[model samples]
Target chain A: MILTVTLNAALDITYKVAALTPHTTHRVGEVVERPGGKGINVARVLAALGHECVVTGFAGGATGAVLRGMLAPLAPHDALVEIAGTTRRTIAVTDGTSGDTTQLNEPGPTVLPEEWTAFLSSYDSLLRDADAVALCGSLPPGIHVGAYAELVRRARARQVPVLLDTSGEPLRRGIAARPDLVKPNADELAQLTGSREPLRATRDARRRGAHTVVASLGPDGLLATTPDGTWQAAPPEPVRGNPTGAGDSAVAGLLSGLVAGLSWPERLSRAVALSTATVLATAAGEFDAAAYERLLGRVTVVEHTQAASGK
Target chain B: MILTVTLNAALDITYKVAALTPHTTHRVGEVVERPGGKGINVARVLAALGHECVVTGFAGGATGAVLRGMLAPLAPHDALVEIAGTTRRTIAVTDGTSGDTTQLNEPGPTVLPEEWTAFLSSYDSLLRDADAVALCGSLPPGIHVGAYAELVRRARARQVPVLLDTSGEPLRRGIAARPDLVKPNADELAQLTGSREPLRATRDARRRGAHTVVASLGPDGLLATTPDGTWQAAPPEPVRGNPTGAGDSAVAGLLSGLVAGLSWPERLSRAVALSTATVLATAAGEFDAAAYERLLGRVTVVEHTQAASGK
Candidate 1:
């Protein structure tokens, strides 16, 4: 079973309004809610791919209950440790006219020290049956900055491959722990490597210690530098809808492929297709299965053999 | 005991952001949650004045649970009915830069036939001990348009004074049932009577069926046409802040003053002061007690002798 951790989970809410005008009241036309957080999102994608996955993290208070309640029927098994603070919420107001989205994100509840320790115990127990573990999203307040690094080290100790997906100091620290893989979007890569070039940034990120680095380039596609070689994968066309969960979908693809022992080229193809399909899907954290299937064979994966030259 | 029915109760959530910009993501700086809806707000204000108030409404699901949990410690008694549908949430995004608020209101849960029937039974039981009842706010989906009218008639039958506060068709239909009082803002008064003139509109509204008509003019204060006489009450100075719950505070002032056997002029004075104080308060459904006291003696109430022509 694949294991995913989301320390700062959320109840993702979408409000559909005729128009989002500042300084005025609006009666939302529709409300769509879903369980959200990076690792939860990745778990959802993996579950959609018919993989048995377990989601373990910190779930607390009313919003956390709502998120967990919504997740109960899904494929991923819930192993979340209880906490005292309520989970946060993320609201996206979609405008009918301009089709633009205005987002409001509430900070997650601060995890107590005891809560963090409880989560570590749960994670260790879950890792016992896990082939791969993923530590995803921002660290909720009260957790140590190197929380992901500790988790990565633990997973490596258990001989379970781990993927770290985060940003800022956590990413910097977690990457140094030499996780099996790290997926950072272009902006996050730039922040980490101080370089805007995807290929150079991915290489710089790998040198920071992950066994492999994958950079999601939004609409363009994925750039990866693995131990065996390097490859750039692009979709047949850019699919534009909501790019909210595209990166998590790519993470799911790569992690699932890694566990399935698929070739690196095949994994990149799957990752690219899944990422594009997620952007094309209407719902958050969901990929249009047919779109993924259609784009699968069409995804282009080109390998760069000049790895030693650092080009 | 005073009873307030918020057929469509809400979990009012306020988010403070640095600035409200359309089509951009915002990190909320602070989050405040309160039990809300017209009658709920009124109940909150009444409780603050040491009035024993009972709040009855449809509450369900996780959001409802949160609302109830928060309301548990408040002064008012909770006798809210349970339903299968989740209660709604209203988010007010206050911009720190401009201090302008943007609101997004979610439609309340659809009350089923059985749910409405259950609520009526609860209302009937509560009315047994109720000296007066206030039916406030919109009718949620699945509830009949004449729901408030029916409640008003029941309260009247029980010899319990009923105050109707709503807008559009609900107000129109409710008025014909002869509620003891109706408090509409300037916009609602104009909509009900097709007159922009407050005196004429208040009289017209009273003629439709309410024994007393009180129209709250934003910043300008209130105009009341009661059986004893007609009076216009204005604050000494306009206190500006958020007007979100000003009308509800007015309803609370009027209702509590009625129970206290205050005269028309005195009740109007209290209502105006409370309304203004609510606007000056920092939190939702709260009035500045000191400001209310300060503004009470300073409120100016002018009685118009030409009541017949409403000149």
Candidate 2:
């Protein structure tokens, strides 16, 4: 079973309205709520792909309880560490007429020192029975920047292949622990390496201690530099819809392929197909099975043989 | 003890931000949540005024549980009837720079037939010990528009003074049951009586079976046409701030004065002072005690002996 950790989980709420105008009253037409965070999203996608997954992280207060309750039916194993602060809610107000979305994100619950220690022990236990582990999302308050770095160290100690997906200082620090894989979006990659070019940034990220680096280029698709070789994967056509959970779906695809011992080309194909399918689906963290099946065989994967040569 | 019934209770959530722009993401600076609805707000204010208040109505689901948990410390009596459907949340996004608030209100939970019956029985038991009953807010779906009307009749049967606070069809139907008092703002009054003038509309509302009709005129204060006499109450100066719970505070002030057996002018003075003070306070349903005291002696209450000549 794959273990996913979400340091900052959220109760994702969506409000549908006719239009959103500042300082005006809106009668929301509908409310949709789901458990959300990078790891949870990945776990959801993995579960949909018939993979056994366990989710562990912080869950607290009323909103946390609601999130856990909602996650029960979706995820099989729940190993969340309870905290004192109430979990945060992320609201997205969608305009029905224009399809515009306004997002409001709360900073999420602050973790105490004991809560962090508690989580470390719980995560260690979960790692013992796990084939692979994923450390995802932002580090909550009171957690040091090296929190993911420490988790990566523990996973490496257990010889468990771990994937780290985060940005900024956490990403920089965690890479030092040499995680098996790190997936950063183009923007995150630029912010970390100060390079506008994706290939240069991916190589820089890999040199910082990531064994493999995958840079997501939005509609342009995935660019990966791994031990075997460098490869690029693109969809047949650009898919358009809510792209909220597309990245997490891609991570799930890569993780699934890695566990199944698929070739690099096959892994990239699955990742691109799943990512595109997720964008084509209605809700975040959900992909249409038919779309995934159809797109799987059509994804274009090309291997790049040219060395970086310090470019 | 005063019994306040919130047929449609809510978890009032306030999000503070630097500014509000459509279709953009906002990092909320702060979050404040409280149990809210017309009756719940009234009950909160009443509790602050040293009145023993019991809050009853549907409280269910995760949001309802959170509301009850928050209300536990503020309110002494919780006679809320449990339901199956989850409660609603009303989000107010306040722009700190402009001091403007954008509101998004979710339609409350649909009350099942069995839930309505359960609430009616609970209301009956509470009314036995209540000096006054306040039926407040809109009727949730699955409940009849005449829900408030039925509550008014029950209150009348128990010889408990009932205050009906709602709008549109429910208010119109509820007033037909001859509630002891009905407080309608300028817009609600206009909709109810089809009259533009406040005095004419107040008289029309009274004629429609409310024993007492009080028309809230926003910054202009209140115009009351009671069985004892007609009076106009205005604040010393127009108070300005958040006016979210000003009406509920006025309801609390009126109820307090009635229980204290104060004269109509004194009651009007208290209502005006409390309403103005609530606007001056930082949060809804809470009045600045010092401000209320200072404003109390300065509010102007004039007896209007000239009856409306069908204007």
Candidate 3:
């Protein structure tokens, strides 16, 4: 079973409006609500892909209850911890005519010290049966900057592979704990490496103690490097729709591939295919089996060699 | 006892952010949740002022549960009927620097026919003991434009004074039912009357079956035309601060004063005073008793003869 942690879960609300004009009242034509957060997104996609996954995180207040209820229909298993403050909501206002989206995210509720302790205590037991752990999204307020690092350390102690996906200070701090894999988008990679070049940034991320670095370049496809091999995987064609949770979908694909004992090239191909399929799906981070199967054959994986491949 | 009906109740969520940029994600500094709808806002303020009020409406799903939980702390009685769909949420993002607010309102869940029947049945029983009833806010989807008209007719059957506050078609349809009172802001009044002139529009509103028309003009204060007289009540001085729910607060004040057997002038003065105090207070729709007491003495009530009121 895969264990996913979303420190800052949200109730994702999509509102369809004729148009959005600043400082004016708008009557929404449609509203759709779902569970949200990078980890939650990853877990949702994994469940849709027929994977066994357990989601554990801090949920609180009324918004948290709504978030959990939304998750009930999507995820396979739930072990979310109850906290004091309510979870936040992220609003996506889409223009019905133009299809352009304006997103407003609420900063999730703060996590107190005792809540963190409770989560870690419960997570230790959850990790014992988990094949891999994925720590995803931004940490809520009051959590230590190195909170993900502690999770990575715990995963290592349990001898379970861990995937880290986040940005900024938390990502930087979590990398030093040497998670099995870290996936950062182009901009996050640049911030970490202080370089615009993807190849250089990927290498820099690996040098920061990540065993493997997967750099997701939107539309351009996925770039990954490991101690044994380096590869670039690209879909034959770009599929366009909503790219909101494409990265999380890719993380789900990669974890599913790893658990299936697929080769690195096959894993990269699966990740690229699933991410592309997610974009083509009606909702973000959700890929139907038919879409995934249709896109699988079109993904092309190319191998690259490092100067010091053995290291 | 006062009965307030919020056909489309919502879980009002507020997020305090440093600033809001369209399409960008933000971490909220603070979060607050309250039960919201115009009538719920009125009920909260009335309850805070120590009035016996019963809140009734259609509530459903997890979001509805959250709304009810939040309302539990504010209202004296609850007669919410369970519906098929969850309640909606309204998000207010406040910019910490300039204090400018950006609002995003969700289109509330559709009220099924069974839910409407349930609510009307419950409302019928509650109306038996109600001295006054307030029909407020927009009609939720799936309900007819004349839903409030039916509610007003029911309230009138019990000889209860009904205050109808809504906008556009609902307000237009509701007025034909001959509600005792109708309160519209400047914009809603103009839309209903097709006249931009406040006095003319308010008088026009009164001519269309409403015994009394009260128009709230924000900083311009309250304008009312009853059978006894036409009066414009303004605060002695402009009280400046947040005006988020000053109109609803005024409605609460008017109802509270009327229930206490105050005269029209006294009710109008108290409405203006409470509204001014609410604007002066830090929280939306909340007025400090001391500030309200001080402002009451400073409200200026000006009487206008119908002949002179014609522009």
The top-ranked prediction according to TM-score is 1
Candidate 1, residues A1-311: lDDT per residue as tens digits? Answer: 99999999888999999998888889999999999999999999999998999998888899988898999999999998889998999999999887789999999899999888888888898999999999999998899999999999999999999999999999999999999999999999999999998888999999999999999998778989999889989998766688889999999999889999999999999999998999899786699999999999999888887855466
Error of 3 at B188 (Å): 2.2
Task: Give fnat for candidates 1, 2 and onward, in order.
Answer: 0.94, 0.92, 0.50
Tens digit per residue, CA lDDT, model 3, A1-311: 99999999888888888877756667777887788888888988888878899999889987788788777876568799999988877878888877878777777787899999999999999999999999999898889999999999999998999999999999999999999999999999999999888787898899999999999999989989887678889989867798889899999999999899998888988898889888888875577568789878779887776554333
Query: Which stretches of candidate 1 lie above 4 Å from their native place?
Result: A307-311, B307-311
Model 3 misses residue A10 by how many Å? Answer: 2.6
Residue-wise C-alpha lDDT for candidate 2, range A116-181, written one tens digit per residue: 998988888888888889999988878999999999999999999999999999999999999999
Among residues 3 or more apart in sequence or in different chains, the pairs in candidate 1 whose N, CA or C atoms overlap within 3 Å are none
Q: Which model, 1 or 3, shows the larger DockQ?
A: 1
Report the Cα lDDT for residue A58, model 2. 93
TM-score of chain B as predicted in candidate 2: 0.97
lDDT of 3 by residue, B153-268 (tens): 99999899999999999999999999999989999999999998888898899888899999999998999988888899999987779898898888888898878989888999
TM-score of each model, in listed order? 0.98, 0.97, 0.93
Residue B191 in model 1: shift from native, Å?
Answer: 0.8
Candidate 3 ranges with C-alpha deviation above 4 Å: A306-311
Which stretch of 10 consecutive residues in model 3 chain B shows the poorest summed lDDT? Answer: B20-29
Worst 10 residues of 1 chain A by lDDT: A302-311
Report per-candidate DockQ: 0.92, 0.90, 0.51
Ranked candidates, highest DockQ first: 1, 2, 3
Q: Please give the range of 10 consecutive residues that has the lowest summed lDDT in model 2 chain B.
A: B302-311
Error of 1 at B295 (Å): 1.8
